[model samples]
Target: MNQPLLEMQDVKISFTTSTGVVEAVRGVDLSIYPGQSVAIVGESGSGKSTTAMAILGLLPGTGRVTGGRILFEGQDITHFNDKQFEALRGNKIGLVPQDPMSNLNPVWRIGTQIDESLRANHVVKGSEHHHRVVELLEEAGLPDAERRAKQYPHEFSGGMRQRALIAMGLAARPKLLIADEPTSALDVTVQKTILDHLDTLTAELGNAVLFITHDLGLAAERAEHLIVMHRGRIVESGPSREVLRDPQHPYTRRLVTAAPSLASSRIRAAREAGLESAELVAATADGEKPQETVISVKNLCKEFDIRGQRGEKKVLKAVDDVSFDLHRGTTLALVGESGSGKSTVANMVLNLLEPTSGTIAYEGQDTSNLSRKQLFDLRRKMQVVFQNPYGSLDPMYSIFKCIEEPLALHRVGSRKEREQRVAELLDMVSMPRSAMRRYPNELSGGQRQRIAIARALALKPDVLVLDEAVSALDVLVQNQIIQLLAQLQRDLELSYLFITHDLAVVRQTADDIVVMKKGQVVEQGTSDEVFENPQQDYTKNLINSVPGLHIEIGTGENLGLAE
Candidate 1:
């Protein structure tokens, strides 16, 4: 109705490669009204970010806008040169990049980075610049803004660093803000706060927001309008609520059904439709007694003594008297925000870190009391899958070697047997045998994670400590991995201690859930009980913090079985 703030008509972007030119965005049409919030949602390589980059004239490498126009305030700037673009960037259109770690300069203090943006845009100067930096940090919700401004990016936590980035992005009070996966790495609660702050700030400043993300739930919940992209083309576009409530495109439907937040209802539908396999259903049949405990953690306490400003020792209770049980062939998820001791508990269970107090029992045997040889042997029964697949895997090693290394170290099988096992492991993870020779850098994020999973399974471990294993993956890839883990649990009768900040994912994969905060267990219950009726205020807040939690989709009885 009103004049659009930013508009893209038939925007085409391409990049020159060794082979030829590859089209990244194909005639995508999108618009964001003044002070409006719009989201572009898609999986990886779907051109969501590419379209955003085109608007900012910041496409990397050999990328160039080959056709169409990007109109800002009724002017077509498609052919704008770097000098012209510089005049608009930061002052007119600000960008909050996806990865804060890579986006922020490591050598600079948080205040210095924000000040540079302010100075570059000529927004403030000298004493006023220093004051502006603190104001920006405070606006971004950073605590003790003045003190925090002196700290480097490394000194801040993941959420804090993201807040610093947000402060920098909004430092100039641009007319439009393009936040690319701004909260992907943050916990759900922290994500909610950051997004809420961004929305409030943008609305107050009359700034339009073009939010690019792979999270369908987040997009649906946060944006007024939604554009679903697939293979460089728009498959669906409309009000976010309308598109999500009744998706017309097959791809959109897949995303909705695959989303872990919505998957719990889908599971109910699958059961009612008898679409799930009989074995899989029977493995988790109701009325059956709970399985025996595989790993039991009791009174787990981890404390770190650090020197304070006055050089006095201060005790930080990373994990305080936390307790939980992982049942045989069941998943137990530890849900909490960053610094909430979820990972600390996981590391303790894996024996990667020793607890200051408490006991970790494996099949009734105290892990701390085990002899060196016994502990070494115990590693064969318990394994871990870390958060970052790329970081977990060695770039120098082939996929086959990565998987085979574990078996070789444990002396589990002969040379030929290990080779055969490697192939089988890859197949189990739905990877082809041909991928064996490829290095980590050659694979996609999902493929690399599968390789990591294969490596974890190589030892034939009965238990797995999956610490945010699928947190970094796209929704589709995350769904696939969740399904794979479900199947593996059924087939191998494996128990899992899943540690993550994603409650949406936990609802889908975890049978039992543990809610932790400040190194303490706030609540614990079955997934159904916890999700449907949370007992603790903290748990309620966590569930409420999940984006799209308010959208009530029809059940199997109403919408029929999901395909």
Candidate 2:
């Protein structure tokens, strides 16, 4: 075999804080050969990202490699200064970070950012930078590259922005391309497109890829080798399929069991089996949804008037004649890519935004012209939990205060009763009561999400608008939250209008799915029906985008034990 493009041997990383020295990565060893694809999979704080940062010399805040060596082309570059690392960064080692909006310059045009990368790395002469930028964007699967190149970051959709980042990363055709959770925020179809294009580019350029993600299924699909990191140490490393199919470590097994792509069908099957055994069932014998409709929508339309720079008028149909019924004690997931009007639909349903032409009926009551008091009453029955756990919670307030505030606002009960209700809510979400005094900053991402759920449930709402609630979590944490939601739904008989781009998660949780594209419903059906046989090309693309389902890891084998 040829010499490894990048190598890490007994690498140790640490950070200095006011409290003490904290070891982030310890005694890690790995190698990335030329054109070889590899991934490090782990939950938050598992140090998978830290390893990538070390290799790229982009570690933040008092972090340093305390031991071992990192070799690039058989030369030790572990202790290279910023100037030395800078030369290698966009030239020999490219990076595609997790978030595009943050990585991109909001002030500059998309083409400008790409041009800067080209100029910095000397990929092309300055005179040829603009043409090269357009070529790169088009190569990254973005359409209408010439027009798209002139647009700013906010003007582009999430998928387009991601393509721009990929273009920037591969602009120099680096020897090693590091993708840190690159498609975590994207929809399944767009994610698949991005990964496919990335694979092609890296393969064509003979560039090795180091993928960082919390999803084991994604790792298995995108890479040949899988490295599982937990608490700064590599617990398992092998062929991706072998590791997923026959996980030796407890953590690896947990990841496989929880990954949505691998376990979506299995989760549904298991949940249904449990329901069949139980005295109470959510569905009928024929697998039909409950006849009782909780929220009904008809001909919902939202239009935004866009005025051009010269004051020319254009109409943007955000939600075009969309209609769906949310049944009692069932989940109806609105699935689509960004700007598909799913979130806009959710907003109107929540009564936060009014539609230009539509009717929303809560329990057969039209909500269009509800009185102030009636709107307040409606809110008590319908609460929303947003996607960002970190941003949703109030850092200044304690967990108890955050949860109790909703109860206090609604005047649900007396002060003592509200306190008791908050306690029960915490217990329902499987959170320790000790967490009540802690602020959002002190808790992990999963814990914060649980708190957010608890807060939303404080009013004993009949419907929960979970807008990408668990999308930001790790697979294991996401599964835990999903299980919690299931238990809550069974106990409370709550109906959910779940909004997300994650079809795999929807496959397990949603009884019915409303697939949208360009502000229109592309397909609508039962989750099983939709997943088993997608009727539309867009729906099929979404299902195909989901990784690891094609890999045969059955319930009787690896996953039954996972459960």
TM-score of each: 0.95, 0.94
Distance from true location, Cα of 132 in model 1, Å: 1.0
**Model 1, global lDDT:** 0.87
Residues 263-371, model 2: lDDT tens digits: 7645445555663422112232224457699999999999999997579998999999999999998899999988899999999999988899989999999999999
* Candidate 1 C-alpha error for residue 500, in Å: 0.7
What residue pairs are clashing in model 1? none
For each candidate, what is the lDDT?
0.87, 0.88
**Model 2 pairs in collision:** none
